[model samples]
Target: MIEVEGVKIDTRHWIGGERVASTRSFPDISPIDERHLGDLDAAGAAEVDQAVTAARAAFPAWAALGPTGRGAILRRVADGIDERREDLARVETRDNGSLLRSHRRGVMPRVAMNFRFFADYAEKLAHPGMEVRGHRERITYDPAGVTAIITPWNAPLMLATWRIGPALAAGNTVVLKPPEWAPLTASLLADIAHEAGLPAGVLNVVQGTGAEAGAPLTRHPGINRLSFTGSVPTAGVIAAAAAPNVVPLSFELGGKSPLLIFADADLDLAVDLAVEQFDNAGQVCLGAFRLLVQEPIAEEFTARVVERARALVQGDPRDERTDVSALISRPHFERVRGFVDRALADGARALLGGGPNTSLNGLYYSPTILADARPGSEILTEEVFGPVLTVQTFADEDEGVRMANETRFGLAATLVTGSAEKAERVSEKLSAGTVWVNCFFVRDLGAPFGGNGKSGIGREGGTYSFDFYCDVKNTVFSPAGWRES
Candidate 1:
């Protein structure tokens, strides 16, 4: 057991409702200061097969419990999460270098909300019923057995439960493979669910790298459905692995999402949202790291945004005053810095931070802004996935919309405009899965959420979530005594 912020956590693979003994382990390093937290027990192919076998054996009984029965247990899991919210939040912050306050106030609560909201929705789910030409049709959703959920590291627990909640609610057994970088909270959650009386093997967590554990899980023939949120390249590999079994796959991949500021927009709100790109040190998959502004207000808006970006505090993530913290690791920090270095070398001007934070130490890249970035520059088009912002100006509404829709990624976008008409008009043209108007990161649990093209393959939220986690079956019958042909 390893203790983080007074919370004792088990860092091991949770399979078959118990912590499995490890043949090998990987070091868990804290991004906060590069300290060794613990050694996480790694699960190889054998352990993954054990998990799948367990899940398959338990699937029938778990699914026998209808949505109402499943929901009752899920609510208890939510209660357990609420009870340990602070402990989970503190461990997540220590593991991932995200803001402690944000984790406490927002992320951890959302984790609990993910379970509770999906539980309520599953209990109240209504399938379509219709009658035509004296024939009645009843549509039913049956749980897809043995779902494999692979989540990213940025927002570990919240994203994991975002998929896990619906899968479990729909009465499907799950084998979750969390990113190796931040895998501790998942172990904590497995304990919470077990303590809440979740059936054995109903929810299993296999902890290891993609190659060792995740690859096996994806390829396991028992997985009826697979949901993954990560890089597009990695998604491709998972797709190929799951192809032989013909598994149903859902992906929420990378994003170079745009934040478009129209001329009629509120400058202060736009500026604030622009600086929000630095949130989580820009590790967020949906962050609008690319800033496109209308030429009329680009100068004023850019100035205000740069001033605000400069004022952003960069320090220990545990500090309440700190706004930005370290990147996930030294390699990620170097990758982010490399993007800025190349952009500057290619003549993109740095309006604010240009490189690592010299004042502070350990993987802290200053919140960077590179203005006058060439249209097709790598910095302008690619995902930095760090606290680096690239600025570009558009002449008019047509150009603004065109620029915003230029990226291959359609994960999300933010549009700041005062006029509802323009908000309606411009949002329609942007090719993103979700669009925010006059705000950023405002989410509704019921909304259909996913991306188009390379960003992702399918949506997951509310009924959309159930749609992925369950299979639909249509039952048609002749009305009254009508005879079938």
Candidate 2:
């Protein structure tokens, strides 16, 4: 609640075992109202160096806690997140225009699992022994050094935990750069982490803009690994930043995710899935925004989806009955609207509600359905992160898969098929990090979530999550070394 210049910036910086601040700052605006959220001090180069230095310094002591002890702390944090689930959801809703009910019902459960699943697997994460045929040495996994975790604002706390929980559990110290828009949830987690008994510098939270805080954190020589969750373009910057050090980066980037619907698919079930794609107004990087249906069912499915869209009620996220809320800000709303306008210009007809809801001062964009969007139109190809959806028909299964992979992104994909063989076939051809057959957005913390190709590098969630957040060192031992011991 640290508001400056009529803007509320959560200036709470967790560094060197304490929460403090930096001397320099910048303005933060709430997207919901274009109101000044606050002025935030950009963590300067020196602060970045100090934070990374602190992580470097803390790594030895923190990692020395060993697997079991580290797991205990993460597990405790998971329990704490559960205990404060309601508060976290409310804060997240306020900070980023997320649906409170979705956060509580859909997200918190995953957050809890993300912590515990990784914690449970922490001890087992360390390598056993691996040998290559004709090789004289045994290889073991070891933590490289301090990690930088840069996350987007869409699902701030959840994404942050997805990185931090595993990084700490795997015996790596962290420098977490949460999106400036939603720093409060990270701050809250920091407090809970300290109470959960994690060491001071083992988990550090730095609040600042991407250029000021994020770039420096990624480029810092002290950082050995980087895990980022954001857009592809932004992730490109991170990749470039990490390049100088040849630092390994795990990116959970953009998605123009396609939902392939077979003609035989259930129309009722398909419409239900359509709303999930527009979840949180479709701000999700993994949002299933592209709905690619087979030709036979396209017209009916499109109409039914449009009907469902019209039925949606946009209002305050806190309202239990509201099905859709506003986009994150006016800019986002404008961007979404712009995409819709372009679609219509390209001959796509709006079969459902399209445009801003003037009735609501909040960043409300009505759920829109564009029928017959040109194959390469911006709405069809680009990630229109709003309540807008594009419905395109493919003649057959192969064509559906082709249309689905038309974008530069391959983040997440969903396929609905009655035949298991069809799903299996489609799953193989689908180029995404996560493929939910007959489903979408069902997450198990132990399962890996990420994308392929330009969608961004690496994966998140599960035991392997720590791998991206951590650089692995090979500890090779020969018979001679064993003899020496």
Candidate 3:
């Protein structure tokens, strides 16, 4: 285990396919107690250069491995992840303050499944069909030279694996720049890659702040592709930096997604899915933050949802009884709290909660539900990445759909309905990349995950994700009559 700030974790930055020690460092805090979990060292610019050089050095050979060999390695990584699933879940719980039950029962399973799904799905990535009507025509798919994967603090390890699994399965070397705020889990996973026997320089992990580590990695001339998951502003900068290099990019940005429930919907099922949508303190990029109910049943639904949210047991992540955990940091906690206060000032009432749990030394906000919320409030319009939900009521189907679509962000949205026809209609009109029918967060490892509009670009979970990290090439075969040149 790597020791830092009184907490020891089995973490290391994997570079050139080996675990390397860090030189410069900062404290890794546990959201639970605001105590120093450990000191995680930053990967200096020199380290980034080394990682990039290694990725470039190994690119040609790895790209030449063909889909079969590349797929095999990815499958093995999936197998290894499953073998160490408990370790991963434990580390994630401590590192991120997510409930152990959720990590073990839900998150870990999806992560491993995603790895295997991509391993098999990569083979189905059919090459473009060619035609030689009068002249020769051909199309071939190949990997982008090197991929720089920058991950966020929320769901760090899982999100990184989703991108890393597909990129490597399609044979692209990777250099991961994890959020310095949430580095341990992702770093540990990379170290595990070495233990699983991946080739040197094929994968690298650099832990540091975005400006120093992420910016340099994105702008690095040697890097040929970028896969990022974070805020929209941050993505704008990354995209601009990579534009000069013309490196292909898959960006999963912010979301102000809406969850709609009609008067005819199943309230019990809606409650369960609603909680799932707000899990990880509503820190995920998928459907979270907003709750829209038909005004006819609005009062009843709000009461039920508030009771359920407040009933949630919040405590140490390690405690099996804990239903929720701490927010990532103090500034984040203050930001969310400040938003809630302003929301109240704008004529909103707290249906459930809006308080700090002082039991924890660090940042901790109670699961909150607000009612009588209007569109003008920032809480209703912007993405609130915390354990908070703002309720907005609409009169009819058209209004609900319009309200759901009225946002700059459209990553994912959900509709709770009994009518299959209505669900399909809503799905078609919704601006989100993925629209869940009767379920808010029933994520499948095999399904494609991404966004449209300001939520960012490209998919990241299955074979389609693999296509994003690769460059397509066309080869024409001539029987001595194929080329006019």
TM-score of 1: 0.98
**Each model's TM-score, in the order given?**
0.98, 0.93, 0.94
What's the count of clashing pairs in each model shown? 0, 10, 5
In model 2, pairs of residues that clash are: 7-36, 7-37, 7-38, 8-37, 8-38, 24-41, 25-40, 25-41, 26-40, 31-329
Tens-digit lDDT string for candidate 3 (202-260): 98888888877888899899988899999999999998999999888888899988888
Write candidate 2's Cα lDDT for 132-240 as tens digits.
5534444444666798988888888888877777787778899988887766678778877888887888888888888888878888888888888887788788888
Cα lDDT of model 1 by residue, 100-205, tens digit: 9999999999999999999999988987698889898998889989999999989999999999999999989999999899999999999999999999999999
Q: Give the best candidate by lDDT.
A: 1
| TM-score winner between candidates 1 and 3 | 1
**Regions of candidate 1 where Cα sits further than 4 Å from its true position:** 480-485
Q: Which pairs of residues have clashing backbones in candidate 1? A: none
lDDT of 3: 0.80
- Once fitted onto the true fold, the runs of candidate 3 whose alpha carbons sit more than 4 angstroms away are 1-12, 132-137, 358-361, 477-485
RMSD of 3: 2.6
Number of the top candidate by TM-score? 1
Ranking by TM-score: 1, 3, 2
lDDT of 1 at 113: 92
Model 3 vs. true fold: TM: 0.94
